[model samples]
Target chain A: MCLKSVEGIVLVVGDNVDTDAIVPGRYLTLTDTRELGKHALEGLDPSIPGKLKERNLIVAGRNFGCGSSREHAVLALLGAGVKAVVAESFARIFYRNAINRGLLVVEAPGVSQKVSDGDRLVIDLESGVVVLASGETLPFKPIAREVLEIIEAGGLIERLRKELQYGRG
Target chain B: MVNVAMDSLTAKILARASGRDRVEVGETVVATVDKVMIHDVTGPITLDLIDNLNARIPKPESLYIFLDHYSPSPSIPASGIHRRFRIFARTNGVINFFDVGEGVCHQVMVEGIVKPGEVVVGADSHTTTYGALAAFSTGIGSSEAAYAILTGRLWFKVPEPLYVRLDGALPSYASGKDIILSVLGILGQEGANYKALEFAGPGLRTLSMSDRLTVANMSVECGAKNAIFPLDEVTLDYVREFNTPIDLSSLSYLRTAKVESPHLTLDLSTLEPMVAKPHSPANVAPVPSVEGVSIDAAFIGSCTNGRYEDLLAAARILKGRRVSKDVRLIVTPASKRVLMRALQDGLIKMLLDAGAVVTPPSCGACFGGHLGVVGDDEVIISSSNRNFVGRMGSPKAKIYLASPVTVAASALEGCVTDPRRYLG
Candidate 1:
């Protein structure tokens, strides 16, 4: 369940990336996560996916994902290889979805200003550290211990499986 | 602090939750769920989570499931959700299952399922529409919704209440949609975040159930839990038409819980048709007051304004005329029942003959997820809630919120214009 830590620069955005902007209303029926990934952030900037194929981090303002409670938005970001998302705040649903899928989402209040696009950065969720290529290190309040356990176990389903198995003995 | 009438469902819910203290920004609270509701889109997901949790359903009567979106349009996935919902309802012995053509979820729940002074959680954000009937309703995620179904309890941090008092009678062609948009314009998009909008005063008496529902439906756009109105004979009569042998036991509880005080009032007699301009949900203006704006599309639907009255109003304006060649008009009914009634009354025909494309009763263009999405640089006049940038399709697209008459008129004019001229 361990994921490879991804490193890159940060792209800051404001609150609320609604579903219409995530994949557009036209492609809602498209269940394929891969195809949906290509269109992620296409609403914000059409070039986000092409740039993300190389690797990047998204730093957003408060309430980063605020519209419809669609899991597709998180799936699209994860499928696009978005290593981590640092935002002042995250929508309750989106935050849970990202954690359940083992995606790294950090709440760094001033993180949006500390990093700019193309400023190379490194994120280590395991170490609870974000290292800017500029040699500056920022520490984040780690997720709840139980949540980290679930993320480390790959997701809720996997964590539940392990818990059930342990209980069976 | 001064006292105010606690007649609003929001006030009652808050009063009941006052013991829990405040739920600060970025904090969580878990409270017992008094009731749970779900619609077609989120129902299947919620049921899946419930099954995965392996929790036996409790108090089936308190769980309400409605098939409003995509009713009778039955795509494979939709059909699958419907089938699964039926199986789940029967196996779990749920009593409040309303199938296709029953009515919109929000309307049906308030009229039949939701009781006064109770906490209700639904998977759909518009579930807050039920607050109009003196109940505390809010939207939750599928996982949380599943948790509610499992334990008959969910967590909620107590939210502060925002009091909006309306005093005067509403002007002609001015509806609750305008009132809410006007309020949203005053209060920015997040002005009432995590708060309950307790709507009170004489102005509420001038509005109908449909109108009240419209106001409550859009409360989410402002990030409030719900906009609630006190229950009166108007609400009770509406409910009586749908359910028989009314229970009077709760009436005494409702009366004993009343808190009386002076109200802050908003006079709406001088109000005009309000519109939330595109690029942002909070960018609103009066229809006649705005000018120099053109439109490429016009839509009327969604849980907010897709009711029978909304359609009839649109039809009244659109009958015997055609939409402008440059304008694409799309209309979707909120529920199959509304669609059937519209069809029976020739409202659908009038819309179609007037060049409106009638679609199935799905969420449709409201979320900009599917059906009638505007293109880049396109400007649309819509009756649906929220005009956030890129909410209807392309980020470059613009959405203008207005009444059904305004939207219908705009479709005929190919621009954003006042509907009063054509109506008269």
Candidate 2:
């Protein structure tokens, strides 16, 4: 079943927030999502993880997740209860990693400018629009259908399992 | 009316992989992958996913596994993971498993495995390095890698190619590292986001294969999906040396394909040594401008710039010279092959004589994983790519990215010095 929507309070961050900032390299050995969550954004600001407890949405500027192909960054966010990341843009690998891991990453330009920390956001995966607390709606480019299928299946591993069982993957 | 379809090498490669005559930009295609790679860091995750999904790889020979990162088991946990990898490889009958000290996956792949016009995916972003060999390569996440390994295929959105035309040979003071850093400076941190950087023009004749590899290795640093050089004598010469058999007729597309227009035309002769200042690969500047900035450490190695050519360049600068008393110099070869070649060439001896600590071939301290991790408030000048915050250790520590020659010069001066001063 496809996820229709996600609504949550957001934590805002600035531009060029890299993967090293999302999950430091030291804790990469900890692959468990929950364990990785404890250190989300540790390099950027230690207090960010504390804020994530209350806000499960992230509003960010351009080039979020800009370094390394470590899936730990996406796992860290998932572990921290981050339901979706609405950024102006994302580094390509991080964008792919997020989708492959079933993380909702919408690239809605200017979404970062209108949204502030703690503001509530409603992301409708179907319409590819983000509904903000101020009632302003921002439309993001719809993700590719192939990518959506992966996300709908709750990640690549799950999707692959189903595909293999069906012998049509 | 022109009937011929003018496609960049990126499009042609993707088209071929997808079993189509041509593919459009932004179109997603389920393409067969010619090669797949995973490192110690991402390898374990892939294995775990494979186990959970109960999937068996149909063709294990296409998969390459390397124990490069946290290599030789940096800790008990790392060793345990490495042990699991060995067992998994043996049980699965995968023959291309590279043991610890073999070298980085990217280095080893290009040494003899990856071929032009092939689609390669690796769990590490530097997999873009294979593009130097005329292959279409990009990095993927662990889960994606697992899926690719099981199916021998993955989907790729054909990226728009950004043509970079080079016009002249690089000045003696500059290397491919400088060329890439300068390009990154022009194209900022995200300038080429999701775009393919295609290299061509007469200047392509000037760069050695090692130089091309260094330039392509850091494509991801500027948000490029992949960076490719055309198949020329330089690439052919290198591949021939390794005895990689290939069908030359099929590779004509690489040499003949052209983009509509060049996005950036660079005169390599005008270039000089460059550095990416503290914290960002795109935060680049000429080496002369950043000269005199003190450094606590200087390192020359990693998949980015740790080849035999890079080592020899550094050795030339360090010969008959002692490293500054205040600066600790660390040299890690990219692979065991590179290490062996360097040792035979006496580059290792020159570095050791210059008071540098030579670590075994591994992705040591490049990602701050194990050896050579910098401390708080420390400043390091490295030849490896990516100087992101805390990348080489403490978040408080700063990293300056440069070529190996610049690294050697800086180690001797205990500061960021112009490599040109010693190059001639």
Candidate 3:
């Protein structure tokens, strides 16, 4: 989790990178999220998942994860050991699903255009800052404090589990 | 009058569900759910997570499960999904299980369980279809659904309302599918991103409840969180199926819950039957412009336009005519009730007699799961909600989205021809 600031290599892609491109629909029936990760980006670039061995941050164009709202895209990215996804904009349902599933995503307008493929950048979720390798810093409107708390707890399910247990106690 | 109704239905519905006097956009509140639906595609994932939590669904009445994605089980893995859904429902005492071939989840939800002004959530994105009947329904992923299943409460951020005003009457051959397709054209791919689409105006009065459902079903194509129409006699009559002899005309909630917006008005009188080309729903074109695009198959079924009326429209064109020799036309109803209704009205016989194979109610053809998947380089004209690359088959296969009328006409011609040519 990128709860605090960390640096990693960035993978750059273009706009409207949809769910089909992330993980093809045929592999969706796999119930386990970890298994879903193996086929990540099989449609667009079959080698992207395996090639993600070193890259932890994905910077892409607008409406990343657009199209049918399946959580498999998020699960696949997580399974591929992706630390975060940054794009100019994201599909509505995918954004919510990413939040609930504890997938770190940053919506930074110029983020994708600024970084080259394999550019190592330092990102801090708490500060909403991305420090580029060129020494230029970009700022983003930070996610709400509550949303950060939920993500820090490893998503809504884990947060609710704690809340429910506390209520029972 | 309609403008005030459009003020914000999301707030009213969420406030009531959360036991708050009012809620504003961006405030996330956990609200009580009227229904929690999971389909064959997303159900197994949700059920598996629930088992880990060691929780049974809190209220069986509010839990709905369906197996419409792969009806009759196309393969062993698909059958495995059905078994998992069945086991979960049986163990949790879920009373709203609709086994394979019953119906698509959206159609079954509206016909059997959804009521006006309730908060409904589902594992599937198209679950936003319930908003047509005045429910605050939205799609949540399987993870959120698992949380809602255990607690009967789901978190919602009240989305801002974007009014899609409709005026004038739909021309001949134009159905609700065209109306929504036109909206998608005007709004583009992400035009309504994160907003709730509120439909209003005199054009709605001339539209049927089925039309409203079709419009609501595809609102997600424009990135809408929910698509809703105001409550009127159309809604009252639809609700009569679940609760009869109930007078809702004087209900204050009806006035507040109905969405209203006058900002973006569309005149249906001038609108043309539309089609979305390959890659995206927003890649729209008029029927005439895209006509004669040769196709190998035509499918008329999906949660988007698969209703009794849609089947009837297709049958009208296929009656007394044969589908082109090379083109295979597959028609699947949205629900068993709709299939039975079509049979009673002789629509099924007309389609079958036209050499159009009318299959059981399922979402197979729409999602490329089974039934009528097209081969690489082959073209298909379909009435399904999406045509994103590889949506119906090989990423190389092209799927064009149109109304049932256009699909039927295209089937008869073996190409993407306009239905107006056949109707006239």
Best by TM-score: 2
DockQ of each: 0.26, 0.84, 0.66
Give per-model CA RMSD. Answer: 4.9, 1.4, 2.3
Question: In model 3, what are the clashing residue pairs, if there are any?
Answer: A22-A41, B5-B260, B6-B260
TM-score of chain A for the candidates in order shown: 0.85, 0.95, 0.90
Error of 3 at B155 (Å): 1.8
**DockQ sort, best first:** 2, 3, 1
Error of 1 at A127 (Å): 11
Candidate 2: tens digits of C-alpha lDDT, residues B139-164:
99998899899999999999998889
Question: For model 1, how does the per-residue alpha-carbon lDDT over B55-118 read when each residue is reduced to its tens digit?
Answer: 6776888788887655653367666778888888899998889887666677666556676667
Q: CA lDDT of each candidate? A: 0.73, 0.90, 0.84
Question: What TM-score results for chain B in every one of the models?
Answer: 0.86, 0.98, 0.96
Given the true complex, what DockQ would model 2 score? 0.84
Candidate 3 chain B least-lDDT 10 residues: B250-259
Global lDDT of model 1: 0.73
User: Could you give candidate 3's per-residue lDDT for residues B227-294 as a string of tens digits?
Assistant: 88777778878888646334364345655433243558899999888999987888899999998899
